[model samples]
Target: MGEARYSRQIPLIGEEGQERLGRSSVAVVGLGGIGSPLSLLVAAAGVGRIRLVDWDLVELSNLNRQILYTSRDLMRPKPFVAAERISLLNPRVEVEVVHEPLVPGNADSIVEGVDLVLDALDSLEARLALGDACQRAGAPHTYAAVQGLFGLVTLIVPGETPCLRCILPERPREEPAFTVGPVPALVASVSASEAIRILSGRGPSLAGRMLVVDLSSPSFEFIELSGECPHRPPEPPPRPAYFRRGDRLYAFEADPSGWERLERRGWAVVEESDAYVRLSGPGSVAVFYSDGGALLVGSRGEGDFREAVGGDLEDL
Candidate 1:
C-alpha cells in the first residue's frame, strides 16, 4: 500500500498505528443506519478483516441514513451490498458477509476470531444478545443505537468493563423506532473511532463510559458506569436463595448489613416489615428479610438486578 493512502491519519496515529490497524479484525453487526457508515469507515481505516452481518434486503426508505447502499442497492441483501461497497473502498481489507440476522445461536460464530465487535443494532434484544455473545467470545464490542435524534455509544471490553446487560439489564420490548440520517452517522463515527483506538492502541477508548448524544437539544453527555457485568461469575448461592420475577431476578442475601451497604450506595429504603425490608432505586428494587434472607428485583425493561448484584438469578 502507498503511504499517501493514510497520509492524513498517520500524522496523528503514526505509521505503526496504521500498520496495527491493518492487522486487526472487526465485526459490524448490522447494515442499517449506524452500521452502514460504520462499516464504510472501518474499512477505510484499513482494518485487515471485517465481518458484515445483516439479514435484511436494503429498503428504499433506508437510503436516508444507510449511505453504503444506493438506489440501485434497494432489494439487495445488506451484507452483500455492504461487503461490496466496503471492498471497493479498501481493496486491501478482507470483507466477509454474513447474510443472516444475529441470534444467540449464531452470534458467537459471528464474533469468533474478531478483534472488535461494532454493535449497530436498533433492537434492544439483539444488542443484548450480541453483548452476551461478545462476552462469551471475550471480544470487545462498541455498542451504539439511534432513536430519532437521540443516540448513545459505549465500549465494552469483555471482562474489564460492563456489558450491555449491565448497562441496561431489562430488555426493551418496544416496536421499531424512528431515526434520522445524521444521528446514526454521528454515533457510528464514534463507534468506528473506538474500534480504531482499541485496534491501534492510539487513543483513549470509552470502555466503561457512555456517550449520549441528543441532537434535538444539541447536547452530548458522557456517563461513567459502575464497572460490573454478567460475564463475571456469580458466587455460590445460599439455600433456596435465588429466584426471579418476570424479567427481573430475585436473590436472598444472608448478610444483615447488605441493605445498609446498598443504602450507602444510593439505594433508598421504600418499605419494611419484620419479614422483609424493601429498597428502591431508579432501576432496581431490593427486599431484606429478618431471617437474613433478601430479595433483589430488577425493573422491567430498564435494568437487571442480577447483573447489578453479580448473581445468576434469572427469570423463572
Candidate 2:
C-alpha cells in the first residue's frame, strides 16, 4: 500500500481500492487509437494483468493518435510494441499479447479469465463479436469509438444492460474513420476510468448510460441506453405456397418437388404445361408454377389465403 506510483489518486481510491485494481485482469481487444491510450492508462493504474490484442502492425501514419508506437517501430507488429511500451510504463503490471485477428472461432479464448473487456475496435463486426464474447463470459465490457472531433463511450454488463448489438442491429460496411489526436485520447481515458471504477468497486457505473463528447465545442452529452440483448440467430424464411411462370401459376399441397403434393391432396387437375400446372379443389382454383411461387383463388370461408391474395372479390 506504500506504492508512490498511485500516490496522487490513492487518497481518492484508498489502499484497498488500489489493491483491488492490482488484482483485476483486463483484456483490451483493439490496439488502435482508442485502445492505445486505454491500455496505457489501465496499466499505469496498476491493473494486475493486461491482455493487449490486435492483429495489425504499426505504421508511420498511426503516430497521429496511437501514442504507443514511434516511427522507428514502423512495420512492426502492434501488440509487441504496445507490450514493450506498457512494460516501460509499469513493469509491475503483467502483460500478455494476442497477435492474431479476433475471429468468431477464437473470441472466447481471448476473453477467457478476464475481469473486464474493452472495445476499442474500428470494425463494426469485431465490436459486436467482442460484445457477445464478453456477454457469454459474464465479463463487464466497455465500448468506445471516436470520429473526427467527437467520441462516445458506453458500459455494457452482459445480460444486465443493453449490449452493443442492441444499439446497432446491422453491421455497417467498414469505412475509413476521420479522427484527430485528442478525440480518441479523451474517449480512451474515459473508458479506462470507467473500467477502473467498476473493477475497484467504486462505481456509479455507466452501465446504462453512454457518454458522448464533442471536443470541438468541448461539450459532453450523456445518453441513457436501455434494453435487453436482442441478438438472436435469424430464422430461415418459410417456403412459398405457389409460384408463377409467364402468365401461368402452380400451387403446392405438400412437397415442393414436382407435383407430388397435388397428387397426394387428391385435387383434380385442370391443366398441365411445361410452364404451369393448374389444380381444381371443390370451390377453389389453385395455380402452381416452376418458379416456386403459388397463387390460390378460393371462396370466402376458405383459409387465410383468400385474404392474403386480396380477398375473394379480387379473386373473381
Candidate 3:
C-alpha cells in the first residue's frame, strides 16, 4: 500500500502529517474548474474525510480544466462524480457528497464537522453565503477564483482574521464571461498547494491577505487587508432597493424591494431589449454594456459606482 500511493508526498508531509490529514475533515464547495483539482489534491494527500458540495451538472465546456470529469461524466452532478473519483483515487479517504446547492439556511449543517472549507464557487452570491456560514460556524475557509490569467487566493479564519464580508462589504453584481482554457489549472494548483500547507500545519497561510496572480503578466502580488472593520450605518427597517448589473455596476435605494414590487405591478419597467435594464427607484439608472459584459455602474448614474464596483470585483 505504501509503495505506490503516497511515497512522493511522504517525505514532505511525513507519516505524522499524513496521519493528521487522514484524521482531518475538509469540505469543498463547487466542483467546477478550480474545485475539481483542489478536491483531487486534498483526497490524494490522505485527507481523512472529504465532503463535496455542488448543485451544478458537468458541461462540455468544463472539460478543459476540470480534471476530475471527462466526456463520459458530462451532465452528471459534480459532487457525485467527484466523490466517485476520490474513492478510486484513495479509498482510505471517506468522501461525502452534498448534491444540492449550499444556501445560508443549510450552510451551518454542511460545515458543522469540517475542519476547513474551500470556496470553488462561480458566483459572488454563493461565496458571500458561504462566507457568512463559515463565520457563523467558526470554521476556517480558503477562497480561490480565476479569470483568464488572473487568480486570487484568500484564507479566512473566522474571527481570527478579516472575514470576506468585512473586506468586501458588497457582493459582485455582474459575472464575467471568461475563456477557461488552461487558467483554471494554474489557479487550482496554487489553491490546492495552499490547502496542503494548511493541512500539514506548515508555512504561513495566506490569511488576512489576498494573493493575486496574473498569468498573462506572469506576476504575483499580495494585497494587505484592512484589519479594521469598515462600518456602515444601518439602513431603515424596511430596507432599500438594490440591483447589481454584471460584475461591478450596482443600484441601491433605502428600500430595494419597493422597486421590485413596482416593476411587478408594471408601475416601473425596464426595457431588456438593449442588453441593458432600467432599475428605477431612488437609485434608478440605465446600465451600459461593455465588451467585457455589463458595465457595473453603482447607484444609478453616480461616477463613484465604477470605482466602487471595480475595486470589489472578484474573477472566477
Candidate 4:
C-alpha cells in the first residue's frame, strides 16, 4: 500500500527503482501455470496495474500446476478468479481481466500502453500474433514456455532483440506435453523477475539471450540469439501513391526535406539517424529517408501524409 509494503525490496533496488514499479503497468497474458505466479510476483513487487488475459475456465486438471486456482474456484473464469486472488494479496495493484485469446484482431490494442506483456500462452500461433503486435507497437514482451520438466524464457525488445517469429519461423506441432508443478513454478518465477527488472528501470536479464531451464537435470542454460525480425503487416494494393512494403506503408516519391515542411505545419521530429528521420503527429509513426520516401506504420498515417503534402496522394 505504501513504502512499508515494499520496504524489504527497496533496499535491494533502491527507492527510485521501487517507485518506478509503482508507475509502470504490465499485462500477463494467460492465467495458467506460469501466469499465476508471475502475476502475483509482479503485483507483490508493487507493479501499479496488471491486465489478466485468458479465455479459459478453471478445471480440475489445471489445479495440478495452476497455483492460482483450487477446487473451490472450479469452472470460474480464470481472469476474474486471478483478479480476486490478486486483490486479496495486494489491494493496491489494479487488475483488469480480458476473457479472450490474443489474436490479430485484438493484439494491437492489447499492447497499446503497457510497459511490458509477458507470454504464458500455450499456443504457438497466439504467441506469434502477440509478438507481431508488440513489435509493431514498440512494446516490450517477455516470453516463457514450459513442457515436461523444461521451459525457456526470453525478453523481446522491439527494434532490438529478435521477435518471436524471427526465432521461430515455423510453428511447431501442438502435441500435448507433460509438465510438473515445480517446472512451471520455477519458470514463472524467473519470468516475473524479468518483468520486474524491466519495470523497475533495471532493464531485462534475457534481452539478447534465452534462458533454457531443465528441472529434470537441474540445468539452467543461456543460449545466444540473433536475427532480424520478419514480422510485418501484409501488403495490399496501393491506393494511388501510397504503397505497402515490409513494415511500412509509405510514399515512394517524397521530398527529402519534407520533414521541415511538415514541421512548419505541425509534425514534430522524434528521432533522426543515418537510416532515416522519424516524425510524430496525430496518426502516424512515420520515418523519412534520404531518398525522399516516407514510411508510415499507423492506420491513418497515409491521411496525415496527404494532408501534410497539401495534395492528394497520387501515383509517383
Candidate 5:
C-alpha cells in the first residue's frame, strides 16, 4: 500500500495508526444501505481485511440507498459485488465475501476473531445473534440501525461499555424496516468513523453512549447508557452448533418460520404469538421465534431438545 493514498488523513491519525488499520480485520454483516456506504468508506480508508457478508441478491428497490450496486448489478449477490468494488477501491486490501445469512448457527464462525464486527442488519434476530456471538468471543461490535428519518449508532466493547442488548432489548416492530436513502448513509458514516477510530487505537467514542440522530429535528442527542458492563463468558457452549447463555439455549441452526413447521408437524402449541410460539415437546417446552432463535425450557439437554423437535437443528 502506498502512503500517498492516505496522505491527507495521515496527519490526523499518524502513520502508526494507519499501519494499525492495515493490519486490522473487520467483518461487515449485512451489505444493505448502511453496509454499502460503510464498506466503501472503510476500504478507502485502507482497512486491510474486510469480510463482506450478505446473501441477498440486488434488486431494483435496493438501487435507491445501496450505493455499491447499480442497475447493471441487479440480481447479483451482494458479497461478491461488494468484494469486487472494494478490491478496485484498494487493490492491496484483502477482501473476503461470504454469501450467507448471519444467523446464530454461523455467527461464531463469521464474527469470532474479527478485529471488529459492523452491524448494518435490519432484523432483531440477526442483531441478537451477532451481538451474542461477538460478546462470546470478546470481539468489538459496531451497531447502527436506521428508522425512517432517524438513526442510532453505538460501539460495544465487551467489558467497558453498554451493549446492543442495552438499547435493543426487544424487537423493533415497523419504523426501522423502511428508511430514506440518506438516513442509513449518514448512520453508516458515523459507524465507519467509530470503526476507524477503534482500529487506529484511539478507542471508541460512542462506547458509553448511544447517539440518536434525527434528520427531521436536526439534532444529535447522546443518551447515557454507561452503567451497564459485562465481561466475556467464562465458559463456551457445550457444542459447536449451539450458543448457550444462562437458561436460554440457541440451536446452531433454526428456521425463522419454525413455528409454522412445528404447526405442520402437529406439535401441540402451549402459546403462540406473531414473534414466537411456545410448544409442548417431549421433554420440555420450546419457544421458537419467527426470525432465527430457539429457547429450550425445562429440558434435560441438547439430546432431549433435539428429540423433542424430532429433527435436525436446521430443520427446526
Candidate 6:
C-alpha cells in the first residue's frame, strides 16, 4: 500500500529520483492557492521534509482554490491546517509548519536546511524578499504568480539564472488587487509539476526562462531574461525595512535591535518619498511621514511592487 501510493510517479521519476525526492527538502511559503497544492503534491511525491509557512486563517473564500483546506478547516491557521492534512495523506513525509509570515529578517533561517524554495505568496513584497534571500543563500527557488486566468512561473538557480529582481526592478508603491477562482487550481498544478520535474531531473528546467500561461486565451509564452543585466549587491544583514509615502518609496537597512518585531507586525514599505513612507495593511495601503513617521491617510493603485523594483524603473 505504501509503495502503491507513489507507484505511478516512481516509474516516471525512477527509483533513484524517488530516493532523491525522499532525501530532499523544500520550503513552501504561503499555504493558500499556490502553496497549498504545491505542498500537498511535494508530500505526495515523497519529499523527505516539507516546511510550510503562512500566518493566515482559512476563510470561506479560500475553498475555491486552496485545495489543502476543507470546510472543517475554516478559521484555522493555514500552515497548521496544511500540516495536519499532509500528515494524514503521507505519514512518511515530515511536515513542519511555521505559523508566521516570511520576511527579510527571518527568511534565511526559515529557508535554511532546505534543498529548494518555492514562492506561493500573493504579495509582491514577500516574493521579492524570498527571491533576495534565496539568491544570497545560494538556494534554488521557483516563483509562480497568478492573476485572473493568467499565471507565470520562473525558476531561479541562484547566480546562474535571472533573479526575481532582475526581471522586476522597482518595488511598487501600492499592492495589486485581483481575484482568483478555480484558476489557482490549474496554476498550482503547473507550478507543482515544474517543481517535481526539477526535483526528479526529468526534463529541461525553466531556469533562465519565464513560462507565461493565459487560461483565458489558453496560450503559452516563454521569455528569456538577459544574463548581462546587473544585480544589486546582496545585503549582508537582511533588513525588514520597506515603506512608502505618496509617490516615493524607501527600504531601510534593517537595524537588528527592532527588526524582528517589525517583521512580525508585517510593517513593510509599500512606497516612500522624502516626505512620507507607505506601509502595507490588510487589503489596504497606509502612508506615514518619513521623518516623524506619522500616519498618512490615503489610497493608491495595486500591483506587485517587486515587479517594478529591479530591472527598469522606466516602465513603472
True-structure lDDT of candidate 2:
0.74
What is the overall TM-score of model 1 with all chains considered together?
A: 0.72
Please, what are the lDDT tens digits per residue for candidate 3 over residues 80-133? 779889999988889886755555556667788888898888888667778877
Query: lDDT values of the candidates?
Result: 0.75, 0.74, 0.67, 0.77, 0.77, 0.68
Q: Which wins on TM-score, candidate 3 or candidate 5?
A: 5
- Give candidate 5 misplaced runs (Cα > 4 Å): 174-176, 229-316
Superposition error at 73 for model 1 (Å)? 1.1
**Candidate 2: tens digits of C-alpha lDDT, residues 1-316:** 8578999878888889899999999999999999999999999998999999875656677999999888986645577778889989999999987755565556778889988898899878667777777777777888898888889999988778887788777766676888899999999999999988977879746888999999889999899987677765233224333332222222233222434455465667666655346566655555454444344544434444444333342222
Q: TM-score for model 6?
A: 0.72
User: TM-score of each candidate?
Assistant: 0.72, 0.72, 0.70, 0.73, 0.73, 0.72
In candidate 1, what are the lDDT values of residues 227-300, reduced to their tens digit? 55645522322223343334744443356456776777677876654444567765666655555645554445
On a 0 to 100 scale, what is the lDDT of residue 263 in model 3? Answer: 49
RMSD to the true structure for each prediction, in A, is: 17.8, 19.7, 12.7, 15.6, 11.0, 11.1
Model 4 Cα lDDT, one tens digit per residue, 181-217: 9988898999988887888888788998999998878
Q: Candidate 6 at 161: error in angstroms?
A: 0.8
Task: By lDDT, rank the candidates, best first.
Answer: 5, 4, 1, 2, 6, 3
**Per-residue lDDT tens digits of candidate 6, residues 144-165?**
8887788888888877777888
lDDT score at residue 69, model 5, on the 0-100 scale: 93
Model 4 whole-model lDDT (C-alpha atoms): 0.77
Question: Which 10-residue span in candidate 1 carries the lowest summed lDDT?
Answer: 233-242
Off by over 4 Å in 4: 233-316
User: Of 2 and 5, which scores higher on lDDT?
Assistant: 5
